[model samples]
Target: MKTLDFIKLDEKSVAPVVESLKQLLADFQVYYTNLRGFHWNIKGHGFFILHEKFESMYNDAAEKVDEIAERILQLGGAPDNRFSEYLKIAKVKEVDSIACSDEAMSNIMQTISLLIEEERAVLDKASEAGDEVTVAMMSDFLVEQEKLVWMLVAFQSGKCHK
Candidate 1:
């Protein structure tokens, strides 16, 4: 008899999605850390506004980290709980102290851009594997993050609310 992991499809097909999800989870952790830095270290002209925004962003990222890990478990894969492991697998590198609001915004924009690309790839893989739950989750993340990317870019360009 086949293994339970192959209940929905061949294990081979689901492997890529699981791997991609792991990487995405790692990236989210890095992003969360950076947002925390931004929230705590941010200073200068927009400190009041950006400090609050960073707090919100980090909170959202925290939720995504949990959701991603739970999804991995749902796929019959163990979620890596080690920061050391995440550091090795994550594409989004850890950012050190950054107090400038503009610099923080730029960092957030770049990180989210990379995250959006990864999410798209994961969405495709999940769709190909007929994993609607993963597909839907990724879709929701993409929609939200894409808007954030747009707003961050707009803020950088002075095209949005200052």
Candidate 2:
């Protein structure tokens, strides 16, 4: 038997919250992957600026993904990584096409909006479940994600254009 320190929850009580965390992890992975794709493939007159910005965003997302997976593991749950698993669990969409600069910005803005919503929901669930560790982890992620969303929204809205 694999010996483990499992934080016991009232499974019946927290089952829905646990399920939501699983879904959140899947969504976070998809968003992280998409951010990396944007970092690698972004091209245009503003390629240099957008490329660097996307790289930073993706790096931050990568860290958050690791943190989320670790939290799931700590909760005695296996983090989902299979494509089918992600497809079913994720609330975030994996865009199937590469877009032009304007479209890319719009896509990122939309994605960030969804991400922010998901993060807030997760935070609330974590708190309600009395999972303080998960709540704190999500709070950290929420702040960073909120900042990234604002940055992306500003760029998309031409507020960053000069």
TM-score of each: 0.91, 0.82
Which residue runs of candidate 1 sit more than 4 Å off their true CA positions? Answer: 1-9, 159-162
Which pairs clash (backbone N, Cα, C closer than 3 Å) in model 2? none
In the range 1-162, model 2's lDDT, one tens digit per residue, is 221235655445455556667777787788777777777777777889988887877787778777877766666567876878888868778865563677667777777777777767877887777777777877887787677777666766765445
**Model 1: per-residue Cα lDDT at residue 2:** 43
Candidate 1: residue pairs that collide: none
Root-mean-square deviation per candidate: 2.6, 2.9
Compare the candidates by TM-score and give the number of the best one. 1
Candidates' C-alpha lDDT? 0.89, 0.72
Clashes of 1: 0
Counted clashes in each candidate structure? 0, 0
